[model samples]
Target: MDQIKARTIEIFLPTGDSKEVSQAIITNESIKIIYISKSEIENQKKRISKIQGCYILVGKDDDGSDLAYIGQTEDFFQRLNLHKKEKEFWDGVYVIQNSSDSFDQAHLNFLEKLMIQEAKKVKNYKLENVKDGNNFSISESKENECYLYFSTIKTLLKTLGFDLFVPNVEEFEINEENKFYFKEKNNNFSGEAIFENDKLIVLKNSIVSNEENVKDNYIQYLKFRNKLINEGVIQKNNENLIFIKDYPFNSPSVAAGVISLKSKNGWEVWKNIEGESLDKKYRQK
Candidate 1:
């Protein structure tokens, strides 16, 4: 019986004339499990002309509960039946019923990414392997043209510590009730993260800035900046700081904490030229 079942599993996914996909087979008398992605399910449904991708969440946890596995397959019924035949824990997936009749899986993919990213910030999930981000390859010039005009508004609101999670980034402008500033293509991405109730811009999102690391604190930087200005290694021209010498500091926090009791944008605080700050001058023209 086991040999026959293994043979069935082997013949499931077809090859493109010669490219075979692999599957995990359990030989032990105890238990074994295999996983498949939701994309695979979505693809299968389209090929067969049917709706797919829904879950029957049997339970929940204190923080976020689920004994069920998130999965995707082309033939939901066939896949579930196959799992029941092979897996020891048949209840998990076999019992689930499809609930998502109108969900756009492509959009759901975005939500899944956001959920995983935010979940890692929680204390219990601190060990999650999700990497810290907002890398340089993200082009600022393209931000205006590629997205729904107010698309990043929630991210801006989230940074400002406001409550704003509407999922769709496009609806904010069309709806007047959104109240937030709908600053279409016009924005100040590189200067001070000027906090306005209407326009919430990322301080680090500025093209002029070095894309701040995730864990940096705006308040802490302020305190650190104040301490540096007092110590004298870095002074100010007007609102910005000026460096009198080569500053050997790293992050804003570190540069703020160490540099001669007086730190500025170390980029601006350390320099060979009089009144020139490394922070601003170091950038290529």
Candidate 2:
């Protein structure tokens, strides 16, 4: 059977607000994901307290970087109550449970360990788990079942805007057709970017001009540039700033603006090897 088969998902918004308490399930699948905001815990306790499952606490750090804490428990409400008092950083939780209460302690342990390992591999969020959970023995058949459950968990988490298991840029295939370049000889500005998955990715090692060259009136972009530098996403090397890792920007214009240190219509400035503007190639149709 093909591994990538189309599947349907159903989401229920208990509070009418997508951000409050939401439940998601794949069609015909027993695994369920409940996203509960810190503020909604009081309202959801009666429904979720007795659930046995693995959960992830999601939040942001002081610098606004994403943070996550993965755990499993026999009673969801009880575990969350402890976190409410002890873990101040998390503002929401995603609980993964079986609809029929089919999972035992062994199953939860296995899933928790698997999730922590994958989250660490992605490095998309700062993990609060100091140690991966203990290994548990399970039947080979049950182990295979756990893998399938994990796959669904990953999908639901991403659907909720948490790309916890998404692959890093280095893992992406570099399609030459999707690649674009921005360069200006006089200012020592040069950058390589790729338009993929609806976002522009500025490849690592790309050179950027000094902040002084940025348009004075574009305060937002200037602050963004400063934040990237402060966060070590980009660093000064000799006479130029260089990206330490591939970074994704919402648009070609934003990527071009940051690279050139000036306001520019990214569509017009980003070009292919043959010097075709991104606008002409992608937006002209």
Candidate 3:
């Protein structure tokens, strides 16, 4: 996997923690990210309005899935003002700007398309903008620069606690020994999985119950299942809900709970091929 080397990031919390308004600047880069609340957009208007780059209006929908609208303009502040009056879904905006004022409309358009495509692939956010983001003709060198800039932007977003582009769990080079499984004899569910790097990934093609059958009223499990369905992480191939792609859950318990549709002790629920449970494995450690 390609990677970005770690570097120093200077942060400015203009309003401290009261308003959740902060800006991050990376050393030796032209990119500056301003994380601002919707209420304070006007307060920082003069500062951000002068920059030219792409901005993301980010928030969550009723179902609790992260949603965002990505757009770019030479006059960042004016475009943000327009969104403030017209859009209601976003609670915050992450403004990515070039300090040197080098990104023109064409460059920003290309960057916007790249960002949207990445957001769609990550499937971490429900994008409010239409998929028809315009693409512009650019030289190979310019394309390279824009993508490099995009990568840096992702790092900054993660630094600010927004990981929209987390690497898909399936993409990891997980070792075979680390694999585990959760099997239910029920007609609808059974699957293999692995927990890696704080993410529990139910492997691709794993079968999930189309119906919730857990003993407890684990509403969150049900909601998570629905969220996966909405995100295309879970799909119906015929009558059964199958995981079309490897899906990452926040924890092993959540992963096991969703598959079992109940309150599960993941330590006992997930086991290796030899039937050795995670509880025993962790105890041995």
Whose lDDT is greatest here? 2
lDDT of each candidate versus the true structure: 0.31, 0.85, 0.82
Q: Taking the tens digit of each residue's C-alpha lDDT, what string does model 3 give over 196-220?
A: 7766788888987778544457877
Stretches > 4 Å off in candidate 1: 1-50, 56-66, 90-101, 111-285
Candidate 2 regions off by >4 Å? Answer: 1-4, 135-139, 168-173, 186-189, 208-245, 260-262
The worst-scoring run of ten residues by lDDT in candidate 2 lies at 211-220
Decoy 2 TM-score against native: 0.81
lDDT of 1 at 31: 13
Q: Quick one: best TM-score, which candidate?
A: 3
Per-residue lDDT tens digits for candidate 2, residues 255-284, read 887777678899898898889988898789
lDDT of 1 by residue, 39-129 (tens): 2433333232343432221222332312233343444556655554654322322111123343344433333344334433321111222
- Alpha-carbon deviation at 104 in model 1, angstroms: 3.9
Where in model 3 is the C-alpha error above 4 Å?
Answer: 1-6, 212-220
